[model samples]
Target: MTQAAAYSAARRKLHWGWITPPVLFAAIIAGATIGETRIPVATVLQVLGNNLLGTDYAVGRIDAGIVWDYRVSRAVVAACCGAGLALSGVVLQALLRNALADPYLLGISAGASTGAVAVTVAGVGAGVISLSVGAFAGATLSFLLVAALARAAGGGMGVRGAGVIVLAGIAGSQLFNALTAFVIAKSANAEQARGIMFWLMGNLSGVRWDDVWLAVPAAALGLGACLWHVRSLDAFTFGAGSAASLGVPVRRVQIVLIGLAALVTAAMVSMVGSIGFVGLVVPHAMRFVVGVRHARLVPASALAGAVFLIVSDILSRVLVPGQVLPIGVITALVGAPAFALILVRGRAR
Candidate 1:
């Protein structure tokens, strides 16, 4: 690369680095500001200042509680879920060499959903296992199942069986989804069923500080894993064989990255339920903006996903005056159309 081009790239990166933090912060504050009860942006900021900066802002106790404990926590969790899922999508797509590869498409979400349902309805853990644990276990199991099926179908390391894996993933997703539904049908009462169903669609209504702790670490771990393997991911762009020829540790890379994808996806799905398309949409969108380099694409996708989900959460709260829609519904409403456009555009090319 020419010095001039390198200098320009550095400048661009610095500019975005300066801009993205404030944009993301503003979106989080916006999420806190607009809700069932409209709060001023000023009040939201004051609440944040009091809680985060220990400033005495004289904010009303009720308003402060609402902003700090409820809205802020929810928005932050949404951001974490968004970032984590998006990173997973980026990793899966790069490693698998498939544009359609994502946690949902790979059956991770379905497996998590099944695990969560099993715990909630079937009482599998019988008060010993948390929903997140169950979900993670299910996600790991499902991934193993899908991997085995793909391998059985003649798909192995590299891009040789990329299409086969996707098909296996679809089959795995259907099977797990059916299991979830069966559990709900057999074990849940009316109220339990309704709550489970809503949660299945994705709910952030009960998110709090505890969830924030889980979400932040989960997202951070995913980002760490992705950033750690950025070069290997770049090598993976051509094909697994190409990556191997370039001295990438093909099997180790696949195991570590894909395993982290499943782990992170399961964690987020456990907390937020099956919010779809984030892993599928955000990375592709970022690629258009940041180009295909994983160094840029990974972080860019994480930021965009965070803001996208925060905005979606806000819309869920205010879209109906008396009723709050599930966050998953809002995501699907936006994502499905966006995905179709991606498909149409891809086809046109």
Candidate 2:
């Protein structure tokens, strides 16, 4: 490459990297501003400054509570969920070489739903286990089941095994989903059942500072892990054998990255319920914008995903008068059409 061309490329990367954080910040502020009652942008900024920088802007207590205590935390958690899930999708798609690969398709979300219901409705730990812990355990179980099934079907982490892995994931998801239904039906009362159903469909209504503590760290860790293995992820874009030939420890990378994906997916689902299509849609959409390179793709997807979910959450709050829809509903309503467009565009290419 010519020196000028190299400089131009570096400039482009620098531009994107600089632009993404501001875009994400704007989206979060927008999320904080638009809610059941509209708060002014100035107030939102003041609330942030007061909370983060100890600057008092003479904001009203109610407005401060709404911004810092409620909307800010919700937006932060949504961003974390979006980043984590999108990173999971990126890893799965690159490693499996399957465009449809995502946490939902791999049974992670289903297992989380089952686990959450088990704790909430069935009293799995008799009030000892939190919903997030239960969900994580269930997610881990589902991944193990899918892995075992794939192995039994003569499939391993290779290009040839992608189909088997997907199939096993489908089976595992169905099994856990059925288990979830059974638990709800047998153990839950009418009110409990209603609450579980709402949560399963993705409810961010209860998100608070506590969730932010869990979610932000999980997302940061997932992003760090992905960045650490960027080269291996790029290599796996070709195939497992190709990655191996390139001195990427194929088995170890597969286990570590895939495990990280599962853990991140579970953590998000546990916190936010089973919001879908962020994973399936964001990575592919980002690939179109950022190119196939993981170096660009990973952070790009995370930023896009965070913005996407914040917007989706904003829509969920405002799309209907006096009612907040489940966030999963909003995501699917948007994601399904976007996904179809992606498919049509891919076919055209």
Model 1 Cα displacement at 310 (Å)?
0.7
Clashing pairs in 2: none
Model 2 is weakest, by summed lDDT over 10 consecutive residues, at 8-17
Q: What lDDT would candidate 1 get against the real structure? A: 0.91
Residue by residue across 10-74, what tens digits does model 2's lDDT show? 78669777997889899999999998999999999999999899996899999999998999999
Compare the candidates by lDDT and give the number of the best one: 1
Q: Count clashing residue pairs in model 1.
A: 0
163: Cα error in model 1, Å: 2.6
The TM-score obtained by model 2 is: 0.94
The total of clashing pairs for model 2 equals 0
Candidate 2, superposed: residue stretches over 4 Å from native: 1-17, 156-160
Which residues of candidate 1, in runs, are more than 4 Å off? 1-16, 156-160
Q: Each model's number of backbone clashes?
A: 0, 0
